[model samples]
Target chain A: MVKTVASVGLPVDEVLEIKKNRILPEGESDGKKKRISIVTGIHGDELEGQYVCFELIRRIEEHKELLKGIVDVYPAMNPLGIDSITRGIPAFDLDMNRLFPGNKDGDMTEFLASGMIADVDGSDVCIDIHASNIFLTEIPQIRINELHKEKLIPLAKELNVDFIWVHGANTVLESTFAHSLNSRNVPTLVVEMGVGMRITKEYCNQLVDGILHLMETMEIWAGETIEPRKPIISEDADDVTYLNAPTAGVFVPRVKHWEHLKKSDEIGWIIDPLHGKILEKILSPVDGILFTIREYPIVDHGSLIGRLLREEARKE
Target chain B: MEKKIIYEISSLYRDNFRVTGFEFGEGEKSVCIVGNLRGNEVQQIYTCSQLVQKFKVLEKEGKIRKGHKVLIIPSMNPYSMNSKERFWPTDKTDINRMFPGYDLGETTQRIAAGIFEVIKDYKYGMQFASFYMPGKFMPHVRMMQTGFENVEMAKEFGMPYVVLRKIRPYDTTTLNYNWQIWETNAFSIYTTSTTEIDKESAKEAIRGILRFLAKQQIIEYTTHEGYKSSVVTDSEMISVRTKSAGIFDSKVKAGEEIAKGQILAQIIDPLEGEVKENLISPVDGIVFFGHNDPLTYANTAVFKIISGGI
Candidate 1:
């Protein structure tokens, strides 16, 4: 069944509405059933979660007899952004993700955010999905705050991601949806995958399998489930090395993404297209595995080119 | 006045990024004024420049108090300001948002950490801030209700209004909130303009700051008691929103008094050149803020009015 989570009056006699798809156990109206929320599209350009939402519902309906709990899929949180292909709410130029647990008495955007948070407040678990910007491509991974490590890391392992990054807490996290839900003890896990403005079917399929496995673990689904792959966990901040551009130019990668490299290996070359000369040679600073790589070719000084997980940290 | 480089970051391709500070008096860290963390805040930098000139005269005449020091940073993000970009030119990150920042973090964070480290221990912190929306504001002093905010001290500025905002979760990362957390009396002063310099309001803001310094005994200068500032919370303000997306024709400027049901602005259709909607005031009040942009989106707040007279 479809339900409107938030509605606000817009211009031209228009109304902006956020809707969600709720699937429940066959013929069961029990309010005590465990519920999981799958949320995405906080950024309109990140559409990886759209396919996952559709696939989750389609498979659940296919095996309706085995469903035992509630599943709510909120695909488009910023519908205007999705419609206009903007990263944030088009007219406001505001990031929807930054307005979590918003003020009820504030502006229209804040009211909408507050309503959405209230609607998803009491879930057993929530998976907040996101994709990288158009400039970068990220492998399937889950980012967990070190503050919520003990309670969240074990749950994140069931998501079939390639890596689990346990990062230190920052003031910025207090306004995020996952942080707000976790503060409420809802056990929200943030999943980041693929690149913005494009969808990778393989990553979506992997995440779907992982979500089903998680559902089975919670006894929300009694159907068959696959065992999720064990993910590499990173806890120390020093274990990751950031690669930034040395000069402004066109970046030409010489190495494949996600490849292991030794110290001083050539990762890429920043070339001056107009001058026909190599401006700078990008190299691996340490023995590590590259997990993040820039997708766009344009390079500016101080632009992040990639991130490498130290090899020793991986072994640990 | 002595000019000094407070923080510097060496660059390979260009001149090093430097945050420069002008010191007026030489004693205890009494007050620190920061301006234009973003590139487009032309009015803020201009206000700070005027303050610098005023301080030079005051310091030459020995008007500064003997036991106090005053520091003014006119512009923080000069790299972005040079390129006419609002944020960091390379990554488009906001330096203002990265307050009390991480030294080993990204470029903006490092810059923030560098600047904050030098000015965090002052007795009073003043930031010339701009609104997120492109608008003109009645010159006022704003404080975040962070339990550490001092509304009494804010009123010393003698601005027309003292706005106390209920702190939100995201606000914890802002410079004013962090300064308050660090036990410094922090306030954000908003002028009538941001990108363009409004001479009248800039002078008003300068007078307000000088009055505040005199009140705190940081300087021996005397200025007019600007206003009996009215204390108002952000929630008490009424927002007037446009019903159509079009060219906005504002009927009243910021700081204007209006009656209930008064037409505040008109949204004119771009193609047909006809008024689509006339935004009317819902309450009799003073306009605290008014949108200054040429075009506005549907449902955007065009004016913020403080309901009722002070």
Candidate 2:
């Protein structure tokens, strides 16, 4: 059996010496086919993606003969986040994922990103895996630039996920790995599923299968023929309603992630832990899908509790 | 002993909602001590307050033989303390990071400026702080790139260790960097993390302060039996980072030494019933502070190993 991993970055010592970041790759395939790079663990605390990548790596290793092209995998881009179980590097308090393409001499993130990005360069496709923001539970989905619908829509379909959100390129700046890769003319798909610090096996399985499906479509791996998943492409993805807490209390969410709700549906209630009084009962403001819900209970006034995916009726 | 309540900054509620800045044992040498910049750092503020009360009684009896004017701001961030928060009430900003604070900025900066304004006349300054996390810390003095005078004075503080470091500015812009700009001798001292208070750390801090006083010839340095210290430079400190995010299974205790690559802890994936990584010691040294909570994130510091022999 061919060993799957290409390299593991040893921690760099400082002037005298200090152990720094770690990076793991999938393989150094001599095959000249178009390549795909699946990367995760930029924020160590957001581990759902890490599991997904591991599963893919295992499958690729077990079936190496089926792989037609190189699939470089960097399991963790930020070891600091993984070590601390935090979204940001604890010591410097820097967000590793936010430091895009990365500076060679900057902080730890810059140095790590530079090396990781180099390994990923020249790949035909890139998949930057991430968990949802800790504050919300996002449906497992692949995000692509809305403008790239002509080229990426079919590719998104091949992922076999629930949603293929063709988001605008202007959503966030080129400060993210996916954005940086996309800017470099590589077709990139940013995958987001589950929530930070917690793993849902169902979502992880979904992402693993989706990545396999994409590999199969690119002819990198030959597997079972997958039925293409039709996605609910939102035209106005930015018109999202954010429900905030009215008082400081423990938020008890009634709605689950990916649930559909009608207007006035009781979503959650904030209860005062000290007095045992129901502080506020949040109701759905519009007939929409429950896109997100806050998992951590401790909430204050103005804390974003949930978000609604507004539905726009199809034109005749 | 002139007893009068002086307001560091006028409170929004009332003028008397003031920080009781304590001035003790007046002389040629002056030292300013501040504590409880974060409201969650209750123990630190309480200790400073108790120290003030102890000195006040001793001064009343004409017992404190110090020729230095020691000023204590027991609770600098009163608003946060009142709300029982780590940051200010309006905006959650750490007050300690607000160095060389603005006189008229946000809540945290204003508090920093007001505190700086009161301590500006002092010859030497020491800031007291508690960590956000819980752990016992060795009494060490931290100074930025200011110079050796502060380090020399820190030696006089007679703490167990004198830690030299350069860190990015946060809390308020008026912190260590600001103190450096003023060309004043300063040190930031802490017992441990934010939550738990260690009695030994408190004792070390108080002892260090007393030692500094004695070294200044303001008081006599009395050596406590069996409480000797080992001095280590910044380079000697080793930080042990966790390899994975899981429930940390720490096999080694702090203050103990083990050979290089010895199993210190295991980051276990509870669901899979598998040990993700076996975190081993990178250096032969004593573990100063490790993760108090078993559950930790990846990239979190599991142990601070000091290499120099004690």
Candidate with best TM-score: 1
Candidate 2 — which residues are off by over 4 angstroms?
A1-316, B1-17, B27-29, B65-67, B131-134, B169-174, B225-235, B272-274
DockQ of each candidate, alpha-carbon based: 0.25, 0.03
lDDT of 2 by residue, A1-316 (tens): 2222222222221111112111122354355666787778777778887778677878777876676666766676666568777676564445665567775543344555666666678888887888876756778777777666677777777776777666666522456777777777777788777888888888887777877788887877776645656666654655456677665667888877778888999999888766778878989988778767887776644556776777552110
Q: Kindly list the per-residue Cα lDDT of model 1 for residues A192-244, writing each as its tens digit.
A: 89888999999999999999999999999999898899998999999999987
Q: State candidate 2's TM-score.
A: 0.52
lDDT by residue (B1-310, candidate 2, tens digit) is 4444444443323323356677778775477777777777866786676668756775677655757777777877676777776565543556666666665354455556766776766777777765544454655677765443356556666566677664332322535556656766777876655555566667667767766665666544465532344556555677777645666778877657677878888887766657888988887777777677756655556678887456
Q: After superposition, how far is residue B21 of candidate 1 from its true place, in Å?
A: 4.6
CAPRI classification of candidate 2: incorrect
Candidate 1 residues B1-310, lDDT tens each? 8899998875535577889999988889989999999898999999999999999999999999897889999999898899897887765678888888877566677788889999999999999999878899999999999899888888999999999999876787789999999999999999999989998998999999999989987888777788999999998888887656778899999999999999999988777788888999999999999998888766577899998876
Best by lDDT: 1
Query: A310, model 2: CA deviation in Å?
Result: 41
The weakest ten consecutive residues by lDDT in model 1 chain A span: A7-16
